[model samples]
Target: MTTFTALTTLDGKAPAEALGAAMEGLDPAPTGVGVFEMEDGSGLWEVGGYFDAAPDEVALALLAAAHGARPFAVSQLPEVDWVAHVKRELAPVEAGRFFVHGSHDADKLPEGRVGLLIEAAMAFGTGHHGTTLGCLRAFDRLLGAGIAPRNVADIGCGTAVLAMAAARCLPDAQIIASDIDPVAIEVAEANLAANAMAGAVTCVTAAGFEADPLARRAPFDLVFANILKGPLIDLAPAVADHTAPGGHVILSGLLTHQAEEVGAAYARCGFNPVASDEIVDWTTLVLTKSG
Candidate 1:
């Protein structure tokens, strides 16, 4: 069966959330609703709803008007087996000694290399993205340089691929994977279990390094943050606070042009850039904290 989506944008988080909440009460209520702040540096928040059936345009218009949002744009979406498509489309991604693959490509996992089983159902960090790949390669390079970190943290770890890599290579190290979205944490746990590394990496639902699980494990020797440019800049100070002197941070999810700014932010927090690699439009940076 086909589905329909209604989307609108409004200023302010409150109005967008209120509009999303209002959408839930409509007749033929939405199967899912999302209210997100657009990351384009545009001050707009997008409110969207998915319905199994066509939504009432009048109702949507009224809701938008009441919320001071633009008129809802509704569209029909074709029903497709997204999981199957992803499995077929995403082959194995190799970054140095790490291989990220779905179960469909399990046989392609090479010998003597660490294999991370990320299923197609998991929507984030399949390692196909340049940012994720860059982070993995950066870590691999560090390992080659004989940088062995005993305490590590993976902030905004969507699928926990980076954390898992650290866990596999540094079996004796303590690794924690964290994400603000609880759903991503669930995905991380699933991925960990799939890799038979369930207990190797602790999974937490927290923003940046705020929660007790992360705070108690402070002064990390290494940290991985594959999040967007804005959050990476905002997180520079907190990352510096939790990192030990001479600790390393592998940061990605930045456009090539944004890397310099992020590097400058970290520099102000006593971090010196060690390496900056650009893969496609994304840039991954490796920086070490100065004593």
Candidate 2:
């Protein structure tokens, strides 16, 4: 069945969330509503709703106006098997010793390499995005240099792909992967099971490093944070506090232009950039805390 989407953006979270809540009371009620920040540090939040039937445009416009948001844009969307589309566009990705592929390409996993099974169902952190690829490569390069981390964390670990890679490389390491969205935590758990890593990495639902369990396991030898620039900048101090002396961090999910600013924030927290990877529009940085 086809669907319709009504979307609007506002300057702050309050109006965006209010608008999202308003969508639920529409005549042709939305199937779901979502509010998310733009992640660019623009302070803009987007409100969107999906509906099986076309939403009442007048109601949408009234809601937008009431929330001081831009006029809502509604459009019909064709039904799509997003997983199939993802599989078609994302071929197997090789980053250093890590081979990330969908089950359809299972036979392509080469010998003597860490294979990460990331089905199209979970698109984020599938090692296909430039950010994820850059992070994986950075991690592999670190391992290749004979540096081993005993304790690690994958913040905002969408599918826990990074954490799993570390698990594969350093079998005895303690790994914790977390995300604020419970759905992402669920996906991470499922991906871990699919890769026969059901309990290899501890999965948690928390915002950034806020989980008490993560705090208890502080001073991690390495941390993988592939979230966008805004949150990365915001979490710099906390990340630095949790990183062991001389510990390493692989940071990404920033555009090429945003890396410098994000790196500068972490630098203020006593981190020094050790390696940088640039792929197309994304940039990933590896940094070390001073011992």
| Top lDDT model | 1
Candidate 2, which ten residues in sequence have the lowest lDDT sum? 37-46
What is candidate 2's CA lDDT for residue 32?
A: 93
Please give the RMSD to the true structure for each candidate, in Å: 1.8, 1.4
lDDT of 2 by residue, 90-150 (tens): 8999999999999989999999989999988887788888999999999999998999999
How far off is residue 283 in model 2, in Å?
0.9
Summarize candidate 1's per-residue lDDT along 65-85 as a digit string, tens digits.
998999999999988999998
Candidate 2 wrongly placed segments (more than 4 Å): 39-43
Which regions of candidate 1 are displaced past 4 Å?
11-15, 39-44
lDDT of each: 0.94, 0.92
TM per candidate comes to 0.93, 0.96
Each candidate structure's count of clashing pairs: 0, 0
